[model samples]
Target: RVRSASYGGTQMRYRLQAGATELHAAAPAMHAHAPGNEVTLALPPERLWILPVEQ
Candidate 1:
């Protein structure tokens, strides 16, 4: 699953998850604009494990 949030004016945050496990996470640092209003961030992939939640 992928989730995204926009901070207005070309700022956004994205999170990726898979089956109760987080795959990648990233947040915008500052407002930046590219040639075609594109922003990119490099993030390392992290290993995630699913743990049972006690209710």
Candidate 2:
């Protein structure tokens, strides 16, 4: 489920969750989205990034 989002001119920030896993991701803004919406992502592996957080 999508919790929140910020859509800029050409990019967007999305907050989504599945079970106990939550993710914040950025992508090009081409469509409109809002809270409580379920989304399916088909990101290409070569264009995806997974950064590890250091605490």
Most accurate candidate by TM-score: 2
**Per-residue lDDT for 1-55 in model 2, tens only?**
8888998779888988978988887768887678899988776899777888878
Per-residue C-alpha lDDT of model 1 across residues 1-55, encoded as one tens digit per residue: 4544445444444454455854333345474233233234454446444568769
Q: How many times do residue backbones clash in model 1? A: 0
Which sections of candidate 2 miss by over 4 Å? none
- lDDT agreement of model 1 with the native: 0.45
lDDT of 2: 0.83
lDDT of each: 0.45, 0.83
Where does candidate 1 have its weakest 10-residue lDDT segment? 31-40
